[model samples]
Target: MKILILKRDKLGDMLLTTPMFALLRQHFPGARIDVLANTYNAWVIDGNTDVSRVWSYQRVKEGGRIHWRAAFAQLRQTLALRAEEYDWIIVANGDASHRAIKRAAWLGGCNLVSYTDAKNSHRKVNHPLEIPRQIHEARRMANLLTPLGISLPEVLPPLRFQLPAEAQTFANQWLAEQGLTPGSYITLGLGARRAKKQPTTEQIIRWTRHFHEAWGLKTVFMWTPGKSDNPMYPGDDETAQPVLDAKLPWLVPFRGPLKPALGLIFNGRTSLFPDSGLMHFAAASPGGVLGFFAETDVSPAPAQWGPVGPRARWLEAPKAVSQLEDASVFAELESLLK
Candidate 1:
């Protein structure tokens, strides 16, 4: 048997679909399971044993016009995928749209499985499942497997993110240089794609001090590595500068590639983040994860996108995350640690 999962989305969204990969491997041990991810998120499953292979293409931004070359490349890749003649092609996203369904149909699978909504019907999907409303993203994705006789478990499994050996080595070396050990510190991620979701610099400093004074754990500060002015990949260099310049002994700054950063986060006691991709990465790791969400009309609510795991917890602010009181955030962290 052969299966192809289309999860060509953001980093956090890609991580959410990992449970589906594990379930597929468990149910069909002999099946060749593969994934079609995008360049941005392919690393999430780089060394995952459940996936036989991974095929990736550059993802064009939504509503942005695609260059002719990029469009041709995508067409060529899609044609190649169609040639594979997969037994099943599952659109792994929860709210698969009409365009997403049509794209999966082009993949030429014997069975095309996806979710159906008002905009998209079952006519295109050989096996269609109704989209589950206001559920964890992982469980919502697992619903698609019902057609193959795989039932959703009462509790979903933890998310997966495999760290490469070299990345692990890099993290270990860096930790040694800083006189730190695994689980002795917290990873503090200071980047959020949205302005309203980010905590203020004062809030960040306060949180770092609270971790040290309350939990006696140092903080390893990290941020998206780039200039904020870059339109393609806006980062938190400017936002992180003041905190980094503070010269706080308990705070160590980290700046590097995503893989090694994952290594550091995996080794930490826990990771604190605003609603961002790094938060999802920490949730997938073995360490504890705490995230803050600012509910907005354009974004999915915490009910759907919140972290999932015994050690994972998220606090949603009624308005912007900046408005969340330091005492409330600290209280939630204490609960998470307990």
Candidate 2:
């Protein structure tokens, strides 16, 4: 049997789809399971044990005008995907838009599965899975498989990713050079695509001081690679400069690919994040996490996208990021670390 999952979304969405991959593996251990995701987020599934392979494509920004060359590239990739002749193609977490559904069906599959709300006419999918809009995104995705007679697990599994032994060893050696080791340091995942949702700059410094002074754990500041001229990937180097310049001997900066970074988290004590892909990475790691979430109209709420793990906990802002009190968040972190 062959199955393909279309999760052409960003990092957080792809991480939430991990449970669906787990379910597919449990139900059809012999089947080959593949995923189609955005190039930037394809790493989320790179080391997934349940997924057989990951196919990637660049994501065109929504509402941004696409040039003819970019459009042609997407078309060529879609045609190549259609040649795979998959037995089942599941469009996980896509809406009922004509463009999205059409692409899912266009991939040349015997059966196409996806979800729809009551308002949708159900014209886009061969297997239309109806579900509520407000539930946790992971559970909502898992429930889509019920029509196939796959009994739901009583408890949803945690998000997951795997790292090679070499990667772990490299991380350990690097930590040793820095006078650190597993379970002795914490990572602060700074920078989100959406900057408004993050705590104020002042708040981060205060929080770092509190963590260092109270928990007695060294801190690693993490950020994505970015250019100074481009706004698209404004790396947190500028944001992290103050803490770096403070000459606080306990802080270190990490900037690199997701795999080794996951390795670092895998060997670490705990982490704090402001609703970024790093939160998902930490949740997948065998470590603890404290994720701060602020209300946003543009994206899903924290209840729907917060970290999921036995040791993972999240704090929802009382109102907005500007109004969030750093003291309250530190209090929550104190409890989690203890």
How far residue 105's Cα lies from its native spot in candidate 2, in Å, is: 1.4
Highest lDDT scorer: 1
Candidate 1 residues 1-338, lDDT tens each? 99998886778888888888888998999999999877878888988888999988776654466667766888999999999999998988888577678878888989999988777855658798878887878888888888888988887666777777888999899999999999889998865877678788788889899899889999999989898878778888888898888889899999887888989998998888888778888887777688888865667677888887777888787778888988888877787676
- Tally clashes: model 1: 0
Per residue, candidate 2 scores C-alpha lDDT tens digits across 1-338 of 88888886667778888988999898999999998877777876777999998887765653466556656778898888788888888877745544556678778788888876555534547788765567777887787777667888878877776666777877988888888878888887764655555666577677777778888888777776675446555666666666667777677777776666777887887888878777876877766788767754556577677788788887776454557777777776676667
TM-score of each: 0.88, 0.82
In terms of lDDT, model 1 sits at: 0.84
- Residue pairs with clashing backbones, model 1: none
Relative to the unseen true structure, what is the C-alpha lDDT of residue 264 in candidate 1, on a scale of 0 to 100?
A: 96
Q: Please give the CA lDDT of all the candidate structures.
A: 0.84, 0.74
Top candidate on TM-score is 1
- Alpha-carbon error at 88 in model 1, in Å? 1.6
Off by over 4 Å in 2: 56-85, 116-124, 164-170, 227-231, 297-299, 321-327
